[model samples]
Target: MHPRSLRHRMEKAAKLLVIIQKHTPEVDCLFAPEKGEQGHVVCEFSGSGMSRSNILQLGKDLEARGYQFTRKANPWLGQLSYTGKADEKPTIILSLPVVKDRVAINEDTPATPYSFKEA
Candidate 1:
Protein backbone atom coordinates (compact mmCIF):
# COMPACT_ATOMS: atom_id res chain seq x y z
CA MET A 1 0.00 0.00 0.00
CA HIS A 2 1.05 3.57 -0.57
CA PRO A 3 2.57 5.54 2.34
CA ARG A 4 -0.21 8.09 2.16
CA SER A 5 -2.83 5.37 2.41
CA LEU A 6 -1.23 3.97 5.55
CA ARG A 7 -1.15 7.42 7.12
CA HIS A 8 -4.83 7.89 6.32
CA ARG A 9 -5.72 4.57 7.95
CA MET A 10 -3.73 5.43 11.07
CA GLU A 11 -5.48 8.76 11.32
CA LYS A 12 -8.84 7.07 11.04
CA ALA A 13 -7.89 4.61 13.73
CA ALA A 14 -6.73 7.42 15.99
CA LYS A 15 -9.97 9.28 15.41
CA LEU A 16 -11.99 6.20 16.27
CA LEU A 17 -9.95 5.77 19.42
CA VAL A 18 -10.71 9.34 20.45
CA ILE A 19 -14.42 8.76 19.92
CA ILE A 20 -14.30 5.60 21.99
CA GLN A 21 -12.37 7.40 24.72
CA LYS A 22 -15.16 9.92 25.12
CA HIS A 23 -17.45 7.18 26.39
CA THR A 24 -14.91 5.06 28.23
CA PRO A 25 -13.91 6.82 31.42
CA GLU A 26 -11.71 3.94 32.53
CA VAL A 27 -9.34 4.10 29.59
CA ASP A 28 -5.88 5.00 30.88
CA CYS A 29 -4.03 5.32 27.59
CA LEU A 30 -4.56 5.38 23.82
CA PHE A 31 -1.84 4.37 21.37
CA ALA A 32 -2.18 4.85 17.62
CA PRO A 33 -0.93 2.48 14.95
CA GLU A 34 2.75 2.60 14.01
CA LYS A 35 4.01 3.23 10.49
CA GLY A 36 3.93 0.39 7.93
CA GLU A 37 1.57 -1.54 10.16
CA GLN A 38 -2.16 -2.18 9.88
CA GLY A 39 -4.39 0.29 11.60
CA HIS A 40 -4.42 -0.56 15.28
CA VAL A 41 -5.15 1.25 18.54
CA VAL A 42 -4.66 0.21 22.10
CA CYS A 43 -7.11 1.12 24.83
CA GLU A 44 -5.49 0.55 28.16
CA PHE A 45 -7.40 0.33 31.43
CA SER A 46 -6.18 0.74 34.97
CA GLY A 47 -7.18 -2.83 35.77
CA SER A 48 -8.47 -1.82 39.17
CA GLY A 49 -11.93 -1.56 40.65
CA MET A 50 -14.42 -1.50 37.77
CA SER A 51 -11.81 -1.20 35.02
CA ARG A 52 -11.87 -4.89 34.20
CA SER A 53 -15.63 -4.97 33.86
CA ASN A 54 -15.67 -1.70 31.95
CA ILE A 55 -13.11 -2.91 29.40
CA LEU A 56 -14.96 -6.19 28.99
CA GLN A 57 -18.19 -4.31 28.35
CA LEU A 58 -16.44 -2.10 25.83
CA GLY A 59 -15.28 -5.21 24.00
CA LYS A 60 -18.86 -6.46 23.89
CA ASP A 61 -20.08 -3.11 22.60
CA LEU A 62 -17.52 -3.18 19.78
CA GLU A 63 -18.60 -6.68 18.81
CA ALA A 64 -22.21 -5.57 18.82
CA ARG A 65 -21.25 -2.79 16.45
CA GLY A 66 -20.21 -5.43 13.86
CA TYR A 67 -16.56 -5.68 14.84
CA GLN A 68 -15.03 -9.17 14.91
CA PHE A 69 -13.21 -9.83 18.17
CA THR A 70 -11.09 -12.26 20.15
CA ARG A 71 -10.22 -12.48 23.82
CA LYS A 72 -6.57 -11.74 24.59
CA ALA A 73 -4.71 -13.64 27.25
CA ASN A 74 -2.79 -12.55 30.37
CA PRO A 75 -2.07 -8.83 30.80
CA TRP A 76 -4.51 -7.69 28.17
CA LEU A 77 -7.74 -9.60 28.56
CA GLY A 78 -9.63 -7.96 25.73
CA GLN A 79 -9.25 -7.17 21.99
CA LEU A 80 -11.44 -6.35 18.99
CA SER A 81 -10.96 -6.20 15.23
CA TYR A 82 -13.04 -4.68 12.47
CA THR A 83 -14.91 -7.10 10.23
CA GLY A 84 -14.75 -4.89 7.19
CA LYS A 85 -11.87 -4.48 4.74
CA ALA A 86 -8.62 -4.95 6.59
CA ASP A 87 -6.89 -2.15 4.75
CA GLU A 88 -9.64 0.34 5.44
CA LYS A 89 -10.48 -0.38 9.04
CA PRO A 90 -8.63 -0.53 12.32
CA THR A 91 -8.24 -3.13 15.06
CA ILE A 92 -8.81 -2.16 18.69
CA ILE A 93 -6.73 -3.84 21.33
CA LEU A 94 -7.97 -3.64 24.91
CA SER A 95 -5.39 -3.72 27.69
CA LEU A 96 -6.64 -4.54 31.15
CA PRO A 97 -3.77 -5.86 33.22
CA VAL A 98 -4.65 -8.12 36.11
CA VAL A 99 -4.29 -6.24 39.38
CA LYS A 100 -3.03 -8.30 42.23
CA ASP A 101 -3.47 -7.32 45.83
CA ARG A 102 -0.26 -6.16 47.42
CA VAL A 103 0.88 -8.00 50.47
CA ALA A 104 3.49 -6.67 52.90
CA ILE A 105 6.15 -9.21 53.79
CA ASN A 106 7.40 -9.31 57.34
CA GLU A 107 10.45 -7.08 57.54
CA ASP A 108 11.93 -9.12 60.38
CA THR A 109 12.22 -12.25 58.25
CA PRO A 110 15.81 -13.33 57.52
CA ALA A 111 17.01 -13.69 53.93
CA THR A 112 17.66 -17.20 52.64
CA PRO A 113 21.31 -18.24 52.55
CA TYR A 114 22.83 -18.53 49.09
CA SER A 115 23.89 -22.02 47.91
CA PHE A 116 27.21 -20.64 46.65
CA LYS A 117 29.41 -18.04 48.39
CA GLU A 118 30.10 -14.80 46.56
CA ALA A 119 33.33 -12.81 47.00
Candidate 2:
Protein backbone atom coordinates (compact mmCIF):
# COMPACT_ATOMS: atom_id res chain seq x y z
CA MET A 1 0.00 0.00 0.00
CA HIS A 2 1.13 3.49 -0.73
CA PRO A 3 2.22 5.62 2.21
CA ARG A 4 -0.27 8.30 1.23
CA SER A 5 -3.13 5.80 1.20
CA LEU A 6 -2.07 4.40 4.56
CA ARG A 7 -1.93 7.89 6.03
CA HIS A 8 -5.39 8.68 4.71
CA ARG A 9 -6.77 5.48 6.22
CA MET A 10 -5.21 6.30 9.57
CA GLU A 11 -6.73 9.77 9.51
CA LYS A 12 -10.12 8.41 8.59
CA ALA A 13 -9.90 5.87 11.38
CA ALA A 14 -9.09 8.58 13.90
CA LYS A 15 -12.08 10.61 12.77
CA LEU A 16 -14.30 7.60 13.16
CA LEU A 17 -12.97 6.93 16.65
CA VAL A 18 -13.89 10.47 17.67
CA ILE A 19 -17.41 10.05 16.42
CA ILE A 20 -17.83 6.74 18.18
CA GLN A 21 -16.45 8.10 21.41
CA LYS A 22 -18.84 11.02 21.27
CA HIS A 23 -21.88 8.79 20.81
CA THR A 24 -20.88 5.79 22.91
CA PRO A 25 -19.19 7.29 25.87
CA GLU A 26 -19.37 4.06 27.84
CA VAL A 27 -17.35 2.04 25.37
CA ASP A 28 -13.61 2.04 24.81
CA CYS A 29 -12.48 2.71 21.23
CA LEU A 30 -9.24 2.23 19.32
CA PHE A 31 -7.97 3.04 15.84
CA ALA A 32 -5.41 0.68 14.38
CA PRO A 33 -4.69 -1.73 11.55
CA GLU A 34 -5.59 -5.39 11.84
CA LYS A 35 -2.71 -7.58 12.89
CA GLY A 36 -0.80 -9.05 9.91
CA GLU A 37 -3.01 -7.14 7.48
CA GLN A 38 -1.87 -4.32 5.23
CA GLY A 39 -3.81 -1.19 4.35
CA HIS A 40 -6.61 -1.96 6.76
CA VAL A 41 -7.69 0.31 9.58
CA VAL A 42 -10.10 -1.05 12.19
CA CYS A 43 -12.00 0.73 14.93
CA GLU A 44 -12.41 -1.56 17.91
CA PHE A 45 -14.61 -1.06 20.97
CA SER A 46 -15.21 -3.34 23.92
CA GLY A 47 -17.02 -2.81 27.18
CA SER A 48 -20.09 -3.62 29.15
CA GLY A 49 -23.46 -2.64 27.63
CA MET A 50 -22.14 -2.74 24.08
CA SER A 51 -25.05 -4.61 22.61
CA ARG A 52 -26.01 -5.33 19.01
CA SER A 53 -28.96 -2.99 19.09
CA ASN A 54 -26.77 -0.20 20.41
CA ILE A 55 -24.28 -0.72 17.59
CA LEU A 56 -27.03 -0.79 14.97
CA GLN A 57 -28.38 2.46 16.32
CA LEU A 58 -24.90 3.96 16.11
CA GLY A 59 -24.69 2.92 12.45
CA LYS A 60 -27.98 4.62 11.79
CA ASP A 61 -26.76 7.74 13.49
CA LEU A 62 -23.63 7.76 11.35
CA GLU A 63 -25.69 7.31 8.20
CA ALA A 64 -27.87 10.25 9.24
CA ARG A 65 -24.65 12.27 9.38
CA GLY A 66 -23.91 11.42 5.69
CA TYR A 67 -21.53 8.59 6.40
CA GLN A 68 -22.07 5.23 4.68
CA PHE A 69 -21.94 2.19 6.92
CA THR A 70 -23.09 -1.43 6.95
CA ARG A 71 -23.69 -3.83 9.81
CA LYS A 72 -22.31 -7.36 9.63
CA ALA A 73 -23.82 -9.94 11.99
CA ASN A 74 -22.61 -13.25 13.29
CA PRO A 75 -24.15 -15.83 15.60
CA TRP A 76 -22.25 -14.49 18.57
CA LEU A 77 -20.86 -11.20 17.39
CA GLY A 78 -21.44 -8.25 15.06
CA GLN A 79 -19.57 -5.30 13.52
CA LEU A 80 -20.14 -2.16 11.51
CA SER A 81 -18.13 -1.36 8.39
CA TYR A 82 -17.79 2.28 7.54
CA THR A 83 -17.16 3.14 3.90
CA GLY A 84 -17.16 6.89 3.67
CA LYS A 85 -15.80 7.00 0.09
CA ALA A 86 -15.90 4.69 -2.89
CA ASP A 87 -12.14 4.13 -2.89
CA GLU A 88 -12.13 3.42 0.84
CA LYS A 89 -14.22 0.30 1.12
CA PRO A 90 -14.66 -0.51 4.78
CA THR A 91 -11.99 1.98 5.77
CA ILE A 92 -13.03 1.37 9.35
CA ILE A 93 -14.50 -1.78 10.85
CA LEU A 94 -16.15 -1.03 14.21
CA SER A 95 -15.82 -4.08 16.42
CA LEU A 96 -17.71 -4.67 19.68
CA PRO A 97 -16.21 -7.58 21.55
CA VAL A 98 -18.77 -9.87 23.15
CA VAL A 99 -17.93 -10.80 26.71
CA LYS A 100 -19.75 -13.67 28.35
CA ASP A 101 -20.45 -13.67 32.03
CA ARG A 102 -18.74 -16.46 33.94
CA VAL A 103 -20.31 -18.02 37.01
CA ALA A 104 -18.06 -19.16 39.80
CA ILE A 105 -18.65 -22.66 41.17
CA ASN A 106 -18.38 -23.08 44.92
CA GLU A 107 -16.18 -25.95 46.05
CA ASP A 108 -18.15 -26.22 49.29
CA THR A 109 -21.23 -27.35 47.40
CA PRO A 110 -21.67 -31.07 47.60
CA ALA A 111 -22.26 -33.03 44.42
CA THR A 112 -24.49 -36.12 44.43
CA PRO A 113 -23.13 -39.15 42.60
CA TYR A 114 -25.61 -40.81 40.24
CA SER A 115 -25.47 -44.39 38.96
CA PHE A 116 -27.23 -45.46 35.76
CA LYS A 117 -28.78 -48.94 35.64
CA GLU A 118 -28.85 -50.95 32.38
CA ALA A 119 -32.34 -51.32 30.97
Best candidate per lDDT, number? 1
Least accurate stretch of 10 residues (summed lDDT) in model 2? Answer: 110-119
- lDDT (tens digit, per residue) of candidate 2 on 1-119: 67876776677667666666666657755444542232334546555476666656666665655555434333233332333322443344566553432332221223222111110
Distance (Å) between predicted and true CA of 76, model 1? 11
The CA lDDT of each predicted structure is 0.50, 0.48
Q: For all the candidates, what are their Cα RMSDs to the real structure?
A: 14.4, 14.8
Looking at model 2, the pairs that clash are none
Kindly report which residue stretches of model 1 are placed more than 4 angstroms away from their true locations once superposed: 1-3, 35-37, 47-53, 75-87, 99-119
Q: Report how far off residue 53 is in candidate 2 (Å).
A: 6.9
Q: Which stretches of candidate 2 lie over 4 Å from their true place?
A: 30-46, 51-57, 76-90, 95-119
Give the per-residue lDDT of model 1 (tens digit) for 5-117.
76787677776666566558655644445633556676665543444445445555555555555442331222222222234467665555553323422222232321111
**Model 2, backbone clash pairs (residues 3+ apart or across chains), number:** 0
